[model samples]
Target: MAKVKINQPFTLLDTRVGVAERQTVQLEVAKLYTHTPMTIPIEVVNGAESGPVLMVCAAIHGDELNGVEVVRQLLSKVDAATLRGTLIAVPIVNIFGFIHKSRYLPDRRDLNRCFPGSEQGSLGARMAHMFFDLVVKKSNHSIDLHTGAIHRSNLPQIRGDLSCEMTKEMAMAFGTPVAIDARLRNGSLRSEASGLDIPVITYEAGEALRFDALAIAAGLQGVENVMRHLKMLRGRRRKQVHDAVIAAATSWVRADVDGIVRAQVTLGERVSKGQILAYIDSPLGQSEEAIIAPRSGIVIGQQMLPLVNEGDAVFHIAYFAHANSIVEQQLETFIDDIGPIS
Candidate 1:
C-alpha cells in the first residue's frame, strides 16, 4: 500500500483536504434550464495515515438507489481519524436523472454508457468527462454500486472483469454470494478505470427506485470487507459465511407471452433446465404460457413487476462451473447471516 506524506493535504477538484479531515466538495456538472447550477456532492474523508485511495460511488443510473443508501451508511460509519486512506464517496452521479427519479438524463441518454467522455460532447458526455477527470482519476481503486432497473430486483452479486487479478480479488473480497465474470462494455466506468490500471468492481442488488434492507446491509458489509482487504481499515477480514462463487456466464429468460406473470421461483433460487419459472396469464384469462428455464443456473435477477410483454426479460440466471447446490447454500447462509430485513 502506498502511503500519503505525513501531515500532507490530499488535493481533489483543486481543493486541498487536510489529513484526518472530512470535506464535501460540490462538483459542478451543469446548469439547469432554469439557470440553477447543478452539482454532484462528493464527500472526501482523508485519514490520519497514508494508504490507498478508494472511491465508492453510486447512482450513475440515478434511480438505482440502493447504492445511494449504501454510500450514505458507509459515510456515516467511516471515521477519518481511524481510516487508513482517503475515502471519496459520491452518492449521486446523475443529478438530473435522480431529481426526476429516472434512469436516463434529460436528453434521454444513459449516463452510464458515456464514460471517459469529452467536454465538447453532449450533456451526458460533458458530465461524464468532468466526473471521470476530477473524481475517478484520483482514486487508486473504486466500487461502483448499482441495483436492478425499475420494477426489477437483483440478488446481491459482484460484477467485474475477473480476468484482471486485482479486480478478481476485490470482487471476492466483497463477499457476495455470486461474482460474475462480466465483460467490460465500451465507455463504461469500469473499462475506463481499468484502462488506467485502477481495479474497480460493481455491486448489483435490490431494485431501482426502492430501498432494500438486505441489499443495503450486505453492500455495507461488502464495502467494509474490501476496505479491510485493501488494508485501508485496520481489522482482521471477516470470514464470509459462504465465499462467493464465480459465474462463467449469465443469461436472461424473457416472457413468452404478453400477460401478467406468476413467478414460481424467486431471486437466489436454484432451478433446473426446463424448470417452470413462471406462468404468464392473459388479462382476459383466455391464454396462458409457462416460462421455463433455458438451462440450469442460479437466479441472480428477476422482474418484480407482474405484468410483462412478450420478450420482456424476466429472470436472469448465472451459470457456474461449481455445483448449483453450493451456490444455493451460499445464498441461504448469506440470508441467514443478515437475518430479516425490516
Candidate 2:
C-alpha cells in the first residue's frame, strides 16, 4: 500500500472512528417482510487532512454494475493516510434490486424516484429517506452513477444541470466527450440534493445487468478527475481532461415500423439530419423501413435489442454546439485519452 500522511479525523454518517482508516459501516434500512434485516453497505475513507466531502455512489437501479466496479477501483486507488477530506462510497444502494437481479424492489418501485422519502412511506420510500438523511445530506458533492435501461447501451457521459458554475466544473472534469444538460425529475436524488445546493451529477455509461470494461474504466477515471478538481487528491493533471462537449438539446429517434432492425451506427457515432441511422426489415420479407435521424447530433445511447416495435425508441441523440463535426472529431480522441480497459 502507498503510504498516506496522517493529519486529521473526519466524521461521516455518524461514524467517527479516526482519520487515515477505511471503514465499512452498515446502515440497517428496514426489515424485510420475510423477518430478515436489510442493510445498506457504506465504505468511508476519511483523509488525514481537511478537504471536501465527496460521495461516490452506485447501483441505485440495482442491475447497473459499471458503477459498482468504478467504486471498487476508486477505493483501491485511494490512500486515506495521505488523503484529504472524506470519500463515502455506497457501491450498492439498491440491495433488494441487486439481490433479485432486478431493476426494482419486490414492490416494483424504482428507488431512484423516491428521494427525500418519508419515514412512514412505502418500503422504497422509507429506504430513500433513510439514505437521504444519513448519506446524501452529509455530502458536499456527489456523483450518482447509472447505466442505460435493459437492452440499451450508453456512451460514457456526464448528465446534469450544467448552468451552475460548480456543477459545470465537475461535468467538465469528467472528460466524457459529452456533457448533457439534464432536467431534474421530482423525487429524484439529484433533485433533492440540488435543493440543498450540493453539486450532484449523474455519470451514465454501459447497460444494466452487465459490465462494460471500457465503461468501468472511464467511470473510474472520471470520478478521480472530479476528486482531483475538488482538491481531494494531489497528482499530475490528467491529459485532455477538458474535452466534454455540452449538449443541451437531445432527442430520441423512434422506430417507425416494427421489425428486426440493423443499426448502421453505434453509440458515440455522429449522425446528420435525414441520415439513415438504421434499417428495419420485416420478418416476412414483405417491406422495409429506415430509421432516420430527426436532426443532426451524435448517438449517445442506442438499443441493443434488434427487435423493435413501431414507436419504440431506437436511438438517443445529443446535440452539441457543433454536433456534426467538432464533437465528432473529439469523440475518438476522448476514447483514446481514457485508454483501453485493463
Candidate 3:
C-alpha cells in the first residue's frame, strides 16, 4: 500500500491543520470593486492514519444547494480522530454564483467549464484555477455534488466516465440505482480532474436553489458509503445496494409546442417507446400537444415548472438494456432507503 506521511501537519494554501485535526480554511477567490475580497470556504479533516485523500465538494454552480447541505451533513458525521485518510469538504465552489444565488459567475460565464485556468483569465476562469490549484491537485479522488438546473428535478443518480476503473468503483459504491456514463465536457472540472488522472464522480439530484430532503439524504449516505469503500472511515452500509447501469444511451425529450406542461410521469419512472411523458396546453389557444418518449428508458430528469417554449427540453431519459420490473422495484426501494428529511 502507498503510504502518506502521518502524525504531521497537512498544509494546503499555506495553512496547516495537524493530523487528527479538523479545521476550516478560507480561500480567497477575488476582490470586489469595493476592495472586498471574495473567498471560498473549505473544511479539511486530515486523519490520524495514512490513506488515500478524498475530496467531497458541492455547489460548483452556486445555485445547486442540495450538495451544500450534503457536504454539511457529511462533515457532521465524520470524526477526524478516527478517520484513516484525509477529507477536504468544500461545500461551496463557485463563491460568486453561490453568493448571488446563480449558476453563473458575475460575468455570466459557466464556472464549471473553466478548468485549470490562468491567473489573468476571466473571472470564472480565475476562480476555477484557484480551486483546482488549492483543492483538486492534492486529492487522490473526489465526488462533485450537483443538482438539476433551475426548474428541473433529477432522480438521484451518479454521472461520470464509468470506463475508468476507479470512477466505476466510486459510482457503484454510491448506491444510486442509476448511473450515467457521461462524456467529459470540454473545459469542465471533471475533464480537468481526469486529465490529472484523478477519478471524480458527480451526484445529481433535486433542483437548483432548492432543498429536497431525499436528495440530501441520498447524497450524504452515498458519500459515507464511498468513504467506507476507501477505508477512510469504518461504517455499516446504509442499505443493500443493487447494481447500477452504465446508461447505453440518453436523450432529452423536448417540448413540441410553446405552452404550459403537465408532466404525466415522475422522475425515476420507467417508460416505453412512444409513451406520453407530459402534456402541454397553450394558454391562448387549443394547441395542446403530447410529449412522448422517443425510446424506452427511465425518466431521470424533467422540468419542474409548467412554463415552456417549443423545443425546450422537458424530460431526460436513459436507456438501460437490463432495466425491467426488477430494476424499477430497486429504484423505489432506493428512494425509501435514503429516509426522511426531518
Candidate 4:
C-alpha cells in the first residue's frame, strides 16, 4: 500500500496545527448549570512527515479512567518531530460525568450511545455531535479506550468488529493476550465511525473509577504498538509479547442467588465448564450457592465487589479455539512481561 502524503497543516476545532508542532485545544461542548463553561480538552500532535491520522480518545463513560492515563503517558512519549503522522488525543470526553465521578451525563444518559448525534438533540446528543464532528471525523483511524463498568474489572483486551480487515489488523497490532471479535453496538462511536469507513478498535482494560498499574502500562504499550503499526511512529516493528488469541464468543455468568460472593477464580484464569467460579453465601452463613461456569473459557472480566443481587453478572468468560491451558500460559507470560508498573 502506498503512503498518503500529509505535509499540509492539520486543522481541527478550527485551529490549524502545522507540521512538527503540538497544540492543545480547548473544545467548548456545553455549559454547566452554574454558568461555568464545559470543554473537552484535546491535544493534536502533527507529525513532520506523512502517515495516517489516528485519534486516541478516552473517558467517554467518564469513570473509565485507565484510558485517560494511557493517553497521558502515550502523549508524554510521542515527539512530533519524529512522528510520521498526526495524533489527536482527547483525554476526557464527558466532562460532566468526570466531574461528578459518574459514568453517565448530568441527564443520566450514556454518552457513548449518543454518537453521530444531532446538533439540536439532548445534552448527550449535542456533546456527542460536537465530538464526533470536530474530533472523530478528522481522523483516518481511531483507538477508543475503555474499562469495565463500575465495580467490575476487565483483563487487558481489544474489542472490535474483527470482520473488517483494517479493524482486525489494528486489533492484532494492539497485542492484547485476548482479542474479542465483538459486534459493534448501535449508536456507539465505533458504529458511527464505521459508517464513515473509519477503522476503530476499542481497548478495554482495568476497572472504572480506579487505575490499575498493569492495565495502564499495557494500555500505553498497546497504543504505541498500534501507532507503530500505522507507521505514525518510526520504529522497527516490535513483535507482540504474545500473539493475541481471537475469542469465538464471550458470555457473562450470572449469580443465581443474591449474597456476598466469595470468588474462586481470577481474571485470565481458564475454567472448565461447570466449575465453581464463585460461591454466594448468605450473611448469616445459613445458605450458600455456587456460581458455575456454563462453558470452558478464560475469565476475561468479573465483578470486583463481593456483594451481588440475584441474576447479577459475576464473571465474563471468552471462548476460544486454542486449548485453555495454552491461553493460560500466554496470559501468564504477558503479565510477567508487563511486571509491576509502579
Candidate 5:
C-alpha cells in the first residue's frame, strides 16, 4: 500500500488505525448543451485496514433512477469510520440522461454499451473511458445497476457469468430471487471489464425513469449483502443466503398481434407449459389473441406498456426443469428478505 503523505490532507489516509477519510472526488467530465457544467460525483471511503476495494455504480443509462436511490439510501446509513475495506459509490454516472430522464445521451449513444472507451472518441465513448479509467480501473470488484429500458419491466434479478467463481460468489451474495447467468454482450461494460480481468455483476430491476419500491428495496438489500460477504463491516452474525439457480437460457414471449395487452401472470410467478400468460386485444375490442407460455418456467420480466406492436416482447421466461413448488419457495423467501424501503 502506498503511504499517503500527512500534508496531503486532500487525500485522507489515517496511518495509525488505518482508517482513511471518506472523501467525495468531483470531476468535471463534460459540458452540457444548456451552458451548464456536468460533474461526476464519486464518494470514496478508503478504509484504514487493507481489504478489497469494491465499486458500486448506478444510473449509467441516466434513466435508471432506482439504483441511484439505492446507492443514496445505502450511503445514508453506512458510517465510514467503521468500515473495514474501501467503498466507491458513484450514484449517478449519466448526468445528461438523469437531467432529461432519458436512456441515452443527447448524441443518442448508449453509455452502457460504450466500454474501454477511447479518449478522443465519441461523447459516450469519452465518458465511458473517463469512468473506466477513474473508477472501474481502481476497484477490485464492482456492481453496475440497471433497470428495464423505458416501458420494459424486470423482476428484480442479478445477472452475471456463473462460470466465473468470483462473479458467481458475488451474484449469490446479491440474494436476488432470480439470477440470470447472462452472457456478455459486445461493447458492454461487463464485457470490457471481463477483458480487463475485472468481473462485474449487473443488477437489473424495475423500469427506467420510474422508481419501483420493491425493486429499490431489493437493490438496497443486495448491496448490503455483498458488503457483508466481503467482510467490509463487522457485527451481527449474518445468515448464509443460498446461491441463485443458474438458468440455462432465457427468452421473451412476444405478442402475436399489435393491440392492447393484458397480462395474467405476475412477475416471479411460475407457469406451466401452454399457460395463458396474457391476451392481446384490438383497440376497438373487436378481436382478442391469447398469449400463452411456450414452456413451463418463471416469468422473470415483462413489459409495462399496455399497448404493443405485433411481435413485441411481452414476457421474459427462464426455463428450468425444477419443480414449481421449490421455485416458488425461493421466490417467496427472496421477496420476504427485502423488507421495506421506508
Candidate 6:
C-alpha cells in the first residue's frame, strides 16, 4: 500500500472557510525516475459549510489538449474562498505521455485500459493504481476528460453508464448536447469507478493535439452544470432541460475503398439511410466512390484525416430514433451556448 500523511489542523471533511481565505491542498504523490517529485497537485476551496467533493481531471491521454486547457481556465476563474467541499483538478496525470506527445506509457501500455492498476506492475500500472487510490477513491464524483483519438474528431459529448441513477443525474447535469449512454468497457476508469461505487463521467470532444473553441466552451459549461447540480455553485436553472437519449447501439462506418476522402457531413449532422457522407476519389478525381450512411442517426464522431484505407472507420453514429426530438432540441441549445467556433 502507498503511504499517506495528512497535514494536521486540516480536516479531510467538513472543512470550514470564509470569504477571505482560500484553502489550497498540496502534496507529493510520488517521485519520478528523474528524481523529481511527481506532485499530485490539489486545490481545496472549502466553503463555510459542507458539500460534495468533485474531481475534474484532464490528460489521461496526453495527446488530448482541450481538457487540459479547460481545467486551466477553470482554476483561473474559480474563487475558492466562496466554494464548497473541494474541487480536485489533476491537469496532467500522464506526465510521461504528455512530454512525449504519445498516448501510452513508455512501456506501451494505455493508461485508460489499465485501471485499478497494480502497484507492483509496470510504470503505467503503478501510476494508475496510485491515481485511483489517492485521487478517485477519495472523491464524491469524478470527470475524466478526453478528446477524439489522434486522427478523429468528436462532437462534445458525455459518455457514461446511464443506468446508475447517480451517473444518469450527473450526465444530465453535464450540459453537453451529445450525451452517449456508453457501455463500460472492462479496465476502463468508468468501470473501475463503478465497481467502487464512485460516480464518474467521461467527456470527449475535439481532436487530439488540437484545441477547438466550441469544445472548450462546452466543457466549461458542462463542468459548471455539474457543479450546479451538486450545489457547489449557484446559477440560473438551465433554460433547456437535458434531453440525452440512450443510444440503443452505435457503430463505425468504415471506408469501402482507399482514396482521398471528401466528407460532406459534419459531427452533429443527422443522416438518413443511404445519404451521402463522403466520397472517396482517386488522386486525379477520375474515379470516385461515394460513401453513404448505412443507417439513420446523428454523427457523433468522424475521421479528421482526408486519406483513407480500404476499411478505415469514417464515421460513428448513434441510433436513437425514438428520442430524436429531445436530442435535436438539446443539440440546438448546446450549439447556441457554445456559439460559433473560434
Backbone clash pairs for candidate 1 read none
The residue-by-residue lDDT of candidate 5 on 124-242, one tens digit each, is 99989888887788778899999998898898889987788899989988888678888898778899888877879999999998899999988887888888888776653254466
Best by lDDT: 1
Q: Model 1: per-residue lDDT, tens digit, 120-187?
A: 99999999999999999999999999999999999999999999998999998898999999999999
The segments of candidate 4 whose C-alpha lies over 4 angstroms from its true place after superposition are: 1-6, 237-239
Estimate candidate 3's RMSD in Å.
Answer: 1.9
For the record, the alpha-carbon RMSD of candidate 6 to the native fold, in angstroms, is 5.5
Lowest-lDDT window of 10 residues in candidate 1?
A: 1-10
Q: Give the Cα lDDT of each candidate.
A: 0.92, 0.88, 0.89, 0.92, 0.82, 0.79
Indicate whether candidate 5 or candidate 6 has the larger TM-score.
5
Residue-level lDDT of model 4, residues 234-267, one tens digit each, is 8854554667899989999999889999999999
Worst 10 residues of 2 by lDDT: 4-13
Candidate 2 C-alpha lDDT tens digits along 224-286 = 888888888887457766558888699889998899999999998888889999999999878
- As a whole number from 0 to 100, the lDDT of residue 225 in candidate 3 is 90
Where does model 6 exceed 4 Å of error? 1-34, 38-40, 237-241, 323-326, 339-342
- The whole-model C-alpha lDDT of candidate 3 against the native structure comes to 0.89
Error of 5 at 128 (Å): 0.5
Ranking, lDDT, top scorer first: 1, 4, 3, 2, 5, 6
Weakest ten-residue segment in model 3 by summed lDDT: 2-11
Give the clash count for model 6. Answer: 0
lDDT: the better of candidates 1 and 2: 1
Residue 292, candidate 5: C-alpha displacement in angstroms:
1.3
In order of appearance, the predictions have TM-scores of 0.97, 0.96, 0.96, 0.97, 0.92, 0.89
Off by over 4 Å in 2: 1-8
For lDDT, candidate 1 versus 6, the one ahead is 1
